[model samples]
Target chain A: MNAFIVIAVCIVFVYTVGFALSLWKQKNKIGAMAVLFLAVIALVLPYFSYFQS
Target chain B: MKQNEGKIGIRDYMAIILLTLGSKVSDDTPTLLYKTAKNSAWISMLGIALLSLIPILFLLKVFSVHRNKNLHEINLHLFGKVMGNLISMGVLLLGFSSFVLDTSVYVDIIGSMYFTRTPTLALYILMLVVCGYGAKRGIESIGSAAWLTLFYLKATLFLALIFAFTKGNLKFIFPLWGPGTLEIAKTTGSKLSIFADFYFLGIIAPLVSSFKEFRKGTLWAFAIVVVEITAALIIFVILFDFTSIEVISYPFHETILYLSIGFLSNVESMFLPFWLVAAFIRFSFYLYLVVTLFGGIFKIKEFEYLVPVFIVIVLFLGIMPKNLTYTLPYLREMILGILSPLFFILPILMWGMAKLRGDFKREAEQSH
Candidate 1:
């Protein structure tokens, strides 16, 4: 279960970065920056928090 | 009311208010009442309902005189440039904080009970995102969703009630007075935080058609929430008894957990969707209020874009607390101390200012 969640976190982080890059290329600064920022809190924090719980 | 292009009938308005009020019977309220009022928790509820009616009626009277002007517009009219905008901004902040507190409440139950392994912020984000989507859909859509889901919501409540009564003992809620008159009055004043949800009614007042519809819908919605909350408390007391609820944490969840309507072993599972949908309606209603508030405050003709920025702020606020233990009490204080006045006082102050200063007299004369 832990392994699966970790992998899920990695996938989400990767996808968000890719999405952010695409938006950045299109000059959508807010949308692009929000992706990476949200990933840190919403996507990554949950992984460590899972273990902490 | 100036920017509000949305029109909802009495039924839709009733549904929005009902869903907003009913879905809020989550664990926070009953537990707080149990801790405060003991066996006479319902008395505090009665006090809250009665006390709450004063603000609602006064705000309604203000709306009646203003006709089609919402709380924001009324504030602008009554208090003028600086004080009016300041007061409206306070209500706006309260609306944002309300959704944050509410989402955290839902996150508490979902994280501790169902998904022990899931991260709290993830759950918060998921709920907020879904709720934000619904909010972005606009008030008419939210109203329609509330209306659409009203039947299932009612059915779930009925099911929970049947299950609760079947296994509950009414002898538990006896003596008729938990903390007696004075203590209950104090608790009622403090517990008035629960009724702050109804403050949304003032924000959406003008979207409602006709004074008749507004009054009828508001009264009906108020009556429904009062009755429903009173019944929920009664059921909770019957099921959990007195002291058990104080230590148990989620009294309503625990009460409903005992329910098993033959074959439907975990009825809460079935009830979850109904709760989510109704809760989404409630969540989106506040979200809508905040966006409208920004439009009024910033003089922005286009607020559709700011919705996401505000949701980002909600996400930040919702996840700010580490957990429910640290979240509930301080939030209780803030809501009762700050947000309550913002929601309750600002509108009343607007009304009082209008009356004292005769600010709206010119508009009234011109309209006639």
Candidate 2:
């Protein structure tokens, strides 16, 4: 479970970063910012979850 | 991609459609089939694929004759300006609402199931952003992504099936026609109309490079998804036994889990990421369609700006129902009762109108 969470989060982080970069390149500022913001939140949320559990 | 200039080939269309339909795996569609049609669920699914073809072929015929017109424009040609715009308005609403519902369902599913302790709202926020980005990239980019994922998607399914065979007991789904033919047919009729979502075919048909590509793409995607789904359910019934099949959530994911348990402590690690990517692309397609169709309806300039707005609407919808159990049946009702038949029969309606007006004859004479 731990290993899976690590790998999954890492994968999401990578993709989210790419998604954000493309949105920026496309001149979709709002989209790029939203994704960057959400990526950070998503990555951080699980630790909060780990503690909750 | 030059195809971004509003043209896509058969392979691009095929990939997009496959990803869109195949990604429904996590929507618990297979489980619904098992429960609704029982051991004959696989066969019932074929019935669905058959049923979908009716509208598909009719629409293709419509496409073949009109050649250049899209669904909305065809509506205008066949129904005349005022009536066409009116019906197009209805289509715009139905397509947008249906896709929003789909996106919401997917968001809710991933959140509740995968990140049990995390906030679904947070997941919804994150996902809608990604979907927005994907939509902004336009359909061509989305199609290209689908094309890239095609190999990985097929290999995953094939691998899952091979593992399923290891412990699969054919008797689990035997007595081949487990449900009465009438019952199976009834389920197929009422529920499978949901597949009428293919009505989007007309909307997307004009975007592809040729009518032939659109037809082949739509039919092949429908056929492949049906076979993949049937194969998944057959394996599901065998692995879990019919007794537990109905109760299982996300049977395809479970099947993946069942196959992966030997090497991985958490089955989801291997499956969920891939499923999520597939789900992401599907959601992006729906998000893009919502913007495109609604923009067409309202004649909104720069519909790309509206992507975030629709994403907000989807998030609201995603959080509307309390949870999955409460929301799914309601969604099914909407699909079976209203959305499917409306969207499904629209092309046929257009075809009939065109025929009545002798539009085909007009086109033939003009060519001569």
Best by lDDT: 1
The DockQ-based CAPRI class assigned to model 1 is incorrect
| Reference-based TM-score, model 2 | 0.82
- lDDT of each residue in B274-359, candidate 2, tens digit only: 67787778888878776676555544435565565456556555556555776775675566667556655776887798889898
Across residues B312-344, which tens digit of lDDT does each residue of candidate 1 receive? 556655666765776665685567666544555
Per-chain TM-score of chain A in candidate 1 equals 0.83
Steric clash pairs (candidate 2): none
For model 1 chain B, where is the 10-residue window of minimal lDDT?
B300-309
TM-score of each: 0.83, 0.82
lDDT of 2 by residue, A1-53 (tens): 55755565667666766766776787876656756665665566556544244
Q: For each candidate, what's the DockQ? A: 0.08, 0.04
